[model samples]
Target: MNKWPVFCLALSAFLVPTAGAAGQDVQAGQILYDKWCAGCHGFDGAGDGYAADYMLPRPRDFTLGIYQIRTTSNGSLPTDEDLVHVIDKGMPGTAMPGWEAKFSSSQINDVAAYIKTFSPFFEREGAPDPLEFGRQPRREGIAEGREFFEQIECFKCHGDAGRGDGPSAPTLQDDLDFPIRAADLTENWNFNGGGSVEDIYRRLRTGMDGSPMPSFSDLIDAQFMTEEQLWHVAQYVHSLSPEEGPTISDVIVARRFEGDLPASPNDSLWNQAEAFYIPMVGQIIADERWFAPSVDGLWVSAAHNDEQLALLIVWHDPSESPDPKWLEWQQSVAASMFPLLDSVGVTPLPDRLTVQFPTSIPTGRDRPYFLMGDARNPVYLWQWSSQGDVVPEATATGLGNVQPRRGESRTLASSAVWHQGEWRLQFGRSLATPDSEAELQFATGELIPIAFYAWDGSNGEQGSQRAVSSWYGIHLEQPTPPSVYLSPVIAMALTVGLGLLVVWRAQRREEG
Candidate 1:
């Protein structure tokens, strides 16, 4: 029997509306909302729609008139323009999708106008003008900005390096008591409103409503900080993120080096290697499916000498696995996602990562199954866990069928470090091994298939419940031959000689 109807009804009752809304006669907007928004925001705009329970930081209850992206001060209504802006741009890092391409300007305005009718607050207290945000000042340096960041205690929630692993991050909840994670300030591209300096300044002044963030207007009124000083804080936050997000590439190129490979992730030699970004998604193809994955992506860099190969993997994580401080956070997430299941007395587990390769290089397009291979074609694996220093080599016929390759096959070595809110791991191995039957041998200029699997133990990710990636290729670049360089020099010398001979012949002909 289909249980969707029963499940939605029970969930809707659990999430009762906080306020009542009157019927509005905006026929056009009502038609659009029913078709696009009702599935998540509910028919009455109470945010009890069928899909609400499955989402974290659940859908916004429009009847309350509380919004997160706004230019107005806290506890105030947003302008009509603000509403239209959110509708057009949508909320990033969430399920909401931008409708600018799908809807016309008039349609968007009509929808924004209709949304206001859901809450009586718009009638009772009208939206005030947006706050004044002056232009950026020519400050001496980011030194003052850094000072302001510490003075305001931004580190209490955003962490020392703005990676969002502060002590208070684990206990934060939204206005509706749903668990919420602090923004990882280092990733400005994920910011809901925008990532520009002006955008950061506006968010700082107004703050995000219906969330733990608070407005700083009182500080200005009380002489705690001048407006320009607040701008410095914005500048400091803006500096945390890179100029642009990393670009995705289909292949990772391993550069050949003359000297030994980098011994650790922090080695300066790694600076010369190119980093490749790979995006990850929750592994939902198998049983015990995971819909939420803490690790979003990874940055990989590879280098090889004649005898050895080294790979550096970097990723951001809010907490070191099994940390006592984040234990409550683990329980809170479990309770929110699976309220009926008993999550008490559950302990955090170690973080894990698996690097997969085919047991033998494929001569054609045919390769082993992506899910750790099938019975017919097995896979070779280098598995690492945060609990130990050794990286074990293994073979797997399929998921949950991994077997550690003891004896001479266990040749993988690794080093790892977790600081602030980031983890850096380096894996090193020989280019060729005696156990070629079970191990993949590296060759220059060959496109080797590779894939990745990661488990964030703090987020209850393990075994099949983890983040995964599809197949990608890695190529070991061959060193340039000496003859190639000599050819270019020889061509230049020949050209010069030919030009001199032609000039001498022309002079001789004129003299005769």
Candidate 2:
């Protein structure tokens, strides 16, 4: 859909009054809601629609009368206009899509009023002040806010630089006791509270209920911070995007070193390498993907130290894989179809993280398909997965040619840790592992073609049901050689000596 029309509609919604508009029809709203909202939020407003269980942060239970995005103060009910705004804009990074273009103004107005009928809170609390946000401050205001952010221990959970990787980061959880992660402030686009400065300010004061995020309104009063100080922190937060460009890169040059390779995945040394953002598309062929991939972006980073190279991959998933219900459902369906296949028994389908490279980086050779390679050419796959009690490092040269790697215990080191709803996996091996034409060797300053693939077992991804990325380049950056420093001294000496030679040649020419 063309965004200009929707943008114009959203702008108009703010200027004019939407509440008590011509369309106050509850029946009309119900019709529209069923057509749109019922897929994720149940018709009864119980938050148990067909797709709701798979969603992260989950959908709001209207019966609870607690809305995350609201104009009313924290714990207070939202006015009619607040509901209309959310309907028009919708939630950005979730399953909720904006309805600006699909529905007319009357439909939106009608639905906003009708949804309130889901709970008794609307009738009992007849009136509440609809909050209004004003202009944001200049740089001075943001600086003052940064001060308050530190004084009140916001840095403990949000990080000192507001990157969301604070000391207390990995321990966060949701109201249901499920693991949850703090939002990375640098990526403001991921903020569920809305991206505008005003939206940030509102979230700062109101706070998200049922999550680790805390309400600063009470904490502010105790700290003796002025009212304006709150807005400043919001401004400071809004300004926190990485000072250059997106923090993610698709084409990355691995950080190279000469000495000691870092073995620990959590070592601070990994910070020297920048994370690359690998975007994945659904493996839609053959109905391979049973559902839309909840994961879209996978972060990668690499570093090499003479003997070995380490690559890290991380992604977020609300639920862990091998869920008993999902596993049983698939097994039952298989048993009904083919009793022979059922005899194989049921087991956990482990999540897969794979790194791919050209079998050999020779000239005039066509690399294989980003998948397991085409019929004509093959690719090298280094796969990491967990089995009954063993974490295996398997190597494959083609689609179905996987084999156990024969090498030292540390030849291909890999480990995975899931925490706070995110998966972190690190893989490393000898620079010359799988030491044959089947593997692409790592070398400094060499450009190598690489691809990536991921499988989420909880999403019913197995066999061909995986997310994959197109081919991209990886390079090991070359350091300046020590011999380069002597060039300046040689040039200076040559210039002086050549100057005298030229003068003598001129005198000899005059004599001739």
- The residue ranges of model 2 lying beyond 4 angstroms of the native Cα positions read 1-22, 141-147, 159-180, 210-212, 219-223, 243-276, 280-353, 358-379, 383-393, 397-402, 408-437, 441-449, 453-512
User: Which candidate should be chosen as best, given lDDT against the real structure?
Assistant: 1
Task: Mark the 10 consecutive residues where model 1 has the least summed lDDT.
Answer: 494-503
Q: Give one digit per residue, the lDDT tens place, for model 1 in 161-227.
A: 9888888988888988877888889889878888888888888899899998777777888999988
Judging by TM-score against the true structure, name the best candidate.
1
In model 1, the runs with Cα more than 4 Å from the true position are 1-25, 138-141, 389-391, 481-512
Whole-model lDDT per candidate = 0.80, 0.65
Per-residue alpha-carbon lDDT of model 2 for 126-208, expressed as tens digits?
Answer: 43886555566554487777888788788777777665556565456666554455676666776776777788888877777
In model 2, where is the ten-residue run with the lowest total lDDT? 494-503
